[model samples]
Target: MVKRTAEQRVLLDQIKQIADGLGQTLAPFCEVVVHDLLEPEQSILAIHNNLSGRAVGDPTTELGQARITDPDYPQVLANYANQFADGRQAKSTSIGIKDASGNYIAALCMNVDLTLFRSLQMAMGQFVQTATDGPKETLDPAGTDALRDRIDAFAARLATTPRALKTEERRALLGELKASGLLDVRRAMETVAAHLGVSRAAVYSYVR
Candidate 1:
């Protein structure tokens, strides 16, 4: 049986509001799937898979080919460490989720959307071309789209504040992001850092 929590339902309603507030529809690719990594009871909370109207059993496969990991960004794996470090300051929007005891839960998150950032990527490309070569126009739309998605995911993971974690708390947080489902731990951490308005290097300090 698929059980939906009040939080899950609220999230769905929020997504709807997001669409209405934007004055544009969410890309069919937009979705929200919650995972309870701490459950005794490990289970997928909600898999709101709505892909461009095409049902592709796995949401990850259906979206544009965004790189799930970045070799240059190693600060990602340490993101889960922030869970115990006083999340109040954890600047990442994705880092805001908490468990029953008001502690942050370790989960594979899928709540954020990157439509707006997609626009920014395009603008940056255009800016580069006009500023560099006004006489010759050059911009790769496909590349820009791909980069935008990667940036969004990476940024989301990177944006967060530490939760003032203890030694044991740090260990547990690391365990969560490095879990099986949380692959490319570095990229994920960097994404969280980007969201938190911090440098990836600062996040890396937590892991060490």
Candidate 2:
């Protein structure tokens, strides 16, 4: 192992401290990790929240290797999507740390589990749906088949399949649903997400 200078150690320690604080601040959903670039075989120096099922002393990631091999690699890569071994989706950001000699020494990564947030969103949407009185002849919100039919009809109007609709078309469909007050129905986003073959987060992105 190459011996790290005192200055290098101090820099790494500072970075670790920042990682620790971030882990605490974004607890339960986010995982913060610090990787030691010098030790690729056991690169993880510290980890928090433990979302990805990776522990300290785990092997380095492909991004870590890229930083070592490519001097032109960006110092920060933000808000990219990732997935865990258990199939949970995450929105991740990574920051590469460099020593005074411009060599990559450490990396700070934050991974936020979108699966949990999506579930919470669905629950909240269900809970907050406005109640109405009177006999309405709309599609049953609880029936997945009904929801799928609505999605298919909307997609048909655009001359595309629900799974192949462009982003703008998806947003338009969502807008139409909202205008029709379908979004106010319980679990509507969940059904739409399923019909579109995407996570609820993707559905929410269009709404947002």
Number of the predicted model whose TM-score against the real structure is largest: 2
- Tens digit of per-residue lDDT, candidate 1, span 73-158: 22122223112122221111221233344432323333323444567889998887735454765453324433335434443454
Deviation (Å) of 1 in candidate 2 = 1.9
Clashes within 3 Å, all models in order: 30, 0
What's the lDDT of the predicted structure labeled candidate 1? Answer: 0.39
Q: How much does candidate 1 score in TM-score?
A: 0.24
What would the TM-scores of all predictions be?
A: 0.24, 0.61
Predict model 2's lDDT versus the native.
0.89
lDDT of 2 by residue, 74-123 (tens): 99999999999999899999999988888898899999999979999999
All candidates: CA RMSD (Å): 24.0, 13.8
Candidate 2 collision pairs:
none
Off by over 4 Å in 1: 1-26, 49-93, 104-108, 111-208
User: TM-score of predicted model 2?
Assistant: 0.61
